[model samples]
Target: GESVGLHLPTLSVQEGDNSIINCAYSNSASDYFIWYKQESGKGPQFIIDIRSNMDKRQGQRVTVLLNKTVKHLSLQIAATQPGDSAVYFCAAEGNGGADGLTFGKGTHLIIQP
Candidate 1:
């Protein structure tokens, strides 16, 4: 099942490692999916995005994979740095318009440097 707004965020990790987070979505009509990273006191920053028409998307050190068949998604961070520590969230564009995004409960990525 996909997540709504009632979820909390938390992350913990070591200084220089890699982390991978997961997300589950339920909307088949969603055409766009995005992954964002939010630090201690900041808003979400776009990490990567994949269109429903595509299966995967990649960014600087981030990768987003979309499995439309099972309605599942995942994000992989390579060579995670201390600064890479943050809460990660997966969002999907609603059926109607691209303006509104449905966010999932984020996973906290903690870095112990």
Candidate 2:
């Protein structure tokens, strides 16, 4: 079965610094990618997304980059803050629908003082 996974389980970034989170997907047919931020005891929140046709997309203070050739995805968060600490996940969908989405294990983003 196709699955998505993160290269690292945790990432620590200093306050006001930029943070980059990486993910890898096994489904080569996936056409859509999404980045989600999950706070403790809450549902994942949508951060940003990118389509297969586009190499990169930006939203607010976040950026999502997709590399189809390597089946890789990345999320960049600008200006790390205390509120930015959470578990970030990368999800992939092959059929352009949420039903077919596969989510990664998630990477814990820690904001350091």
Candidate 3:
């Protein structure tokens, strides 16, 4: 049914390089999107977010892009670092924001030296 998923399960990036994580959602009605980062043994931490009305949003070191027509989303990280190694997930909130979010399988971001 309606679900979110990533194009890749694992992504490797060299230190100091930029990283891009992609996701796809099946729900066309989804209005809000969120990107989260989860470290080992920790819950997912909010990284960035974008609304359907907008196409892009930026945070301190991250940027989130939304493509409503294709139901695709992506997160870009600047200057990959060791501390950035984590599993990143994309979530979608639909049904007027009452039903909460549906998360993707997640992508393991590996920072390589």
Off by over 4 Å in 2: 96-99
lDDT at residue 90 of model 3 (Cα atoms): 98
Clashes of each: 6, 0, 0
* Every candidate's CA RMSD: 2.8, 1.2, 0.9
Task: Provide the global lDDT of candidate 1 against the true structure.
Answer: 0.78
RMSD in angstroms between candidate 1 and the native structure over all alpha carbons: 2.8
Between prediction 1 and prediction 3, which has the larger lDDT?
3
Clashing residue pairs for model 3: none
User: In model 3, which regions exceed 4 Å deviation?
Assistant: none
Ranking by TM-score: 3, 2, 1
Residue range 1-113, candidate 2, lDDT tens digits: 67999999999999999999999999788888899999999999999989899999988889898899999999999998999999999999986574678899999999999
Q: Which stretches of candidate 1 lie over 4 Å from their true place?
A: 1-11
Worst 10 residues of 1 by lDDT: 1-10
TM-scores of all predicted structures: 0.84, 0.95, 0.96
Per-residue lDDT, model 3, residue 33, is 94
Winner on TM-score (2 vs 3): 3
**Model 1 alpha-carbon miss at residue 61, Å:** 0.9
TM-score of candidate 1 relative to the true fold: 0.84
Estimate candidate 3's alpha-carbon lDDT, on a 0 to 1 scale: 0.94
For residue 71, what is the lDDT in candidate 2? 91
